[model samples]
Target: MLNRLFLPSIFALLIYGFWVSAEFKVIAAGVAVFLMGMVYLEKGFKLYTGGLLENILKKTTSTLFKSVSFGLATTSLLQSSSLVSVIVISFLSAGLIGLETAVGIIFGANLGSTAGAWLLAVFGLKIDLSSYAMPMLVFGLLLNTRAAKPLKGMGYILIGVAFLFLGIHYMKEGFDKFQSSIDLSAFHIDGIYGILVYTFLGAAATVIMQSTNALMVLVFSALAVGQLDYVNSLAIVIGSNIGTTVTTVIGAIGANAQGKRLAAAHLLFNVVTAIVGVVALNPLMVTVDEIATLFGIHPHDYTLKLAIFHSLFNIIGIALFIPFIKLLVKWLKSLFNDSYSKEPLNLAKIDESSMERAIYLNPAVLSYPDAAMRALTKESGRLYRNTLELICYGIYFSGEQLRNTDNLSELAENWEKEEQPWSIKGLYIRHIKGIYADIIHFAGALEGNLPRQQAQELFALKVACRNFVQAIKHVKHIYKNMGKYIESENDEIRHQYNQLRLCLASVLKLVDILGVRRNYNHIQEHAAQLKLELHEQDQQTYSTLNKLIRSEQVDSYMASSLLNDSAHVHDACTNLIDGAVIMITRDREEYREYDLAGFTPAAQKTSS
Candidate 1:
């Protein structure tokens, strides 16, 4: 309800303000332009995300200190903590970085964000930045029209900087004009009550603006013009710091649970810092003054003093929180768990409708290449397992029987005494089809949005998914005949079909092990082993069929049926092994089926 009313209420309020005061209109326009500049800046940085930024994150996120340093440096340069937060959230969702490292980055970003306040205070109030805007905008627009991505990214950065300068100039001008017309200082409340009221107003403003940098610049503008007091401005800074988490929280709404946890951690860090800043305002201000002196800052320059205070308080927050990040992560995980968070498998709680969908495949992950690839890989793993289940059920067997049973002959002999059959078609529709479609659709959507190597990875994943689908088709063709002949009166026919099931089962067991035992040698060994065994089974099927035919132990009809079914078994098993190898090894030539390239023909003949 509040969300529904928020936009109209804000619109009405802005309209009323515009009607009443020309100064208010200018200030609001400045804020709007500043926000637009920030958006451009974020976009500019994101165009460069997958290369240097992604590499830096991977290398630096190993330790809390390194993570904090990375966050501080990036935020200092980019001047957008929101951009850093987005990157962190994407990495967290992708399982690229740990929650502790993410929390540390958030802590450092708060400190780094204070650099913006310093930049605006020191330069924005002193210079006529409007003089710098025009040339930047012209160059930016020209480069923006270029086809090259790097040129386009540079263009956005220049344009964004120009708008920021323009916005600051207007805000400074508006505040000067507004101060002459009416004294906002006359309405200021004193001491604790003043701090409380102003802080609440600041937080509300940030929530509406959805930006700390813009809010800081606006406050700095008013402070420079002597329309707002330093003490109240400090309270507002605290409020703005707390309010910044709103952007992080909103960004996480469509993200995975890991992203949400990082969002919560951001809120907690900011709120704690805000609380410390509020409770120890006098002592902290004294500390800020002392720190300002060390840097030769004029004691009367409240704008620089405010910047010092902002950086100091955030540093204090980091000093307080860094030691306990692990405990915090543990608590947050306990509070929130994803449906797919139960480690390797055990995804999809299996609804009453008997339908299943992709678990790791959320839209929020699509913006980042690493996140998107990881999500697809995890979803494909689930698809492989589900396809295995469907194939096993199609042929009158269970995964448990495939893995555990040693006496497959006895199990097959007793098939006639079993209960009624179920439809492989219905089973696939219920479970496998939805998941497969989601995987394929997501991969297709991700195409052209990735780097060259990652795009190749996406293509390999699609091919693996296709292989799984083909395996299902082959199994569906043999399913009916298996059901009919497993109950055959003739023992020889039943035995031959039973052997076919065992052949397929052998491949299933190998694929199943791929999920459990993640060793490199195991993947190579199992893959090569399946190829040789399946080929030997093919030879044995042909040899046994000829013996049964020539001895007239089987009629032509039975012989033809066995021949067709054996070929289907070979094809199905081949597809299963191929798909499993591709999905597990992730298209790496070394780990893939080419590892079986060294198999000897003599060894195959010996196995037969």
Candidate 2:
């Protein structure tokens, strides 16, 4: 509803402004062009998102000071606090960085944003930039047409810079011309009332434009043209500072609870900063003037003074809040608890027709490769848990019993005594299929910015999901026959089917242990032992089947069904073990030992 109203209103305002003054139209056009340039500039920077920026972010955010410095340096270089905010939120959602570190980055981003004002005030207004813009636009356009992706990205950046310069030039010219016909200075308010009103206007302009850097550029250009008073400009700066959080808020809308908490922290930080700036407006202005005088800047240079004020207030905000980052994180956690913490384990209550939405995967995290990889890995873990449940229940044993350290034979005996009417297809449709589909869809949606190593990891995860689903299907194939034979009056057939259940259940138990064991050496050791045990079990099962058939205890049909069903069970166990190995090992070095061991299943070795 707000979007519906906001668009038409903006259009109407633009039309009215153009009708009232040709100068207004030129200024509006300049703002439009500059915003477009910002879009291109952000796009160009994204080309480097694959691993370089993500790695730097991961490394730099270890300490609060480093996080702040990273935020400051990144925003200063990019000249877009909104981009920094988005990256911070992405990292937070992906669990790559803690919330306190994310807040620190945001605080530094606020300080770093002031650099744009300084750049424009010190150089943009002092010289004619239009002369430089023409050549930049020419080169940028040429580069944009290049075949290489990086070259094209560079071209877009060049064009963006050219557009920014041209836009500033046009805005200055239009505002200067408008000063002759209309004195915006006449409308300037004084005292607290004026500060509040102009601050709101500043925030509203930024919210509408969705770029504080653009808004600052306009403010500086207007100030240079004598169309905006120094006091009013400061008010607008305060408002713009507060307004910058809108982008992050919007980005967090579809994110997980952690993302929302980070976004809330961002908004809280900015609001506090804005409030302090407004309350201390007079004192800060005096400080800005004093700093200006110390640096040999002319007292009459309001543009430069405004830049100093912008940095000064943000620095004060950072200094005031830096010590309390932990408290802020604690507060945010209390406010927004983890969304998945309370998920019900009742399989019977699952909605069969509902699309299983991704719990960890969100588009907001896609721009940061590290974050994207983390989200995908976490989602895969969720899928594995659900699939584990389905597999356990399909075998007539409850997932709880399989996960526990109880004897598999005892658990299978206890379950067999009851009338277990398990529905493998219903469970697969209700619990497994939806999550598997979601995982596949999320993997397909990942951006190409992921590092090659991370990309391979993602592929491994997808393959794990596939292997798990295949394991379920194999189990489904044997479930009916196992169920019928387990209740048979024939003692030999009933015993054989029970052994099949025990074998599969033992594999499930080992997998449960593998999922929780963290030590690298221990996991590899256990996995090796498990491979041997499964191999021994397969040999024993075949031996028993041959004895029963030779002794005439089982008919040919019974022997054939037992052999095929046993193979299905073996195949399912092998797939589950392979998938577990992939999920547990962190790196190729850890995987090398397993690969060298060449622990192929008997069926595969025999077939080959």
Using lDDT as the measure, the top candidate is: 2
| Residue pairs in candidate 2 whose N, alpha carbon or C atoms collide under 3 angstroms | 50-449
- The per-residue C-alpha lDDT of model 2 at residue 236 equals 99
Query: For every model shown, what is its TM-score relative to the native structure?
Result: 0.84, 0.84
lDDT of 2: 0.81
* C-alpha root-mean-square deviation, each candidate: 5.5, 4.9
Model 2 poorest 10 in a row by lDDT:
592-601
Worst window of 10 by summed lDDT in candidate 1: 595-604
lDDT for each residue of candidate 1 in 1-608, tens digit (9 for 90 to 100) = 98999999999999998998999989989988888888888777767776577688788878889989988999998887877887788767766677888888888788889889989878888988989988999999998999788999899998999898888888888898998787888877888899888888888888898888899989999998889988999999999988888888987886778889999999989998888988999999999888889989898999999988888889899999888888898998987886543432211233334566776676666776766787788778777877877787767776556667776667665654445344678767766798899888888788878766677567767777878888988898988888888778898998888888878876787677676775555675676777888888889889999999999988999999899988888888888876776676664645222212332222223435
Local distance difference test values of all predictions, in order: 0.80, 0.81
Model 2 — TM-score against the truth? 0.84
Tens-digit lDDT track of model 2 for 428-540:
77667877887788777783655456666677677678879999999999878876888899999998888888888887777777678745566656666777887888799
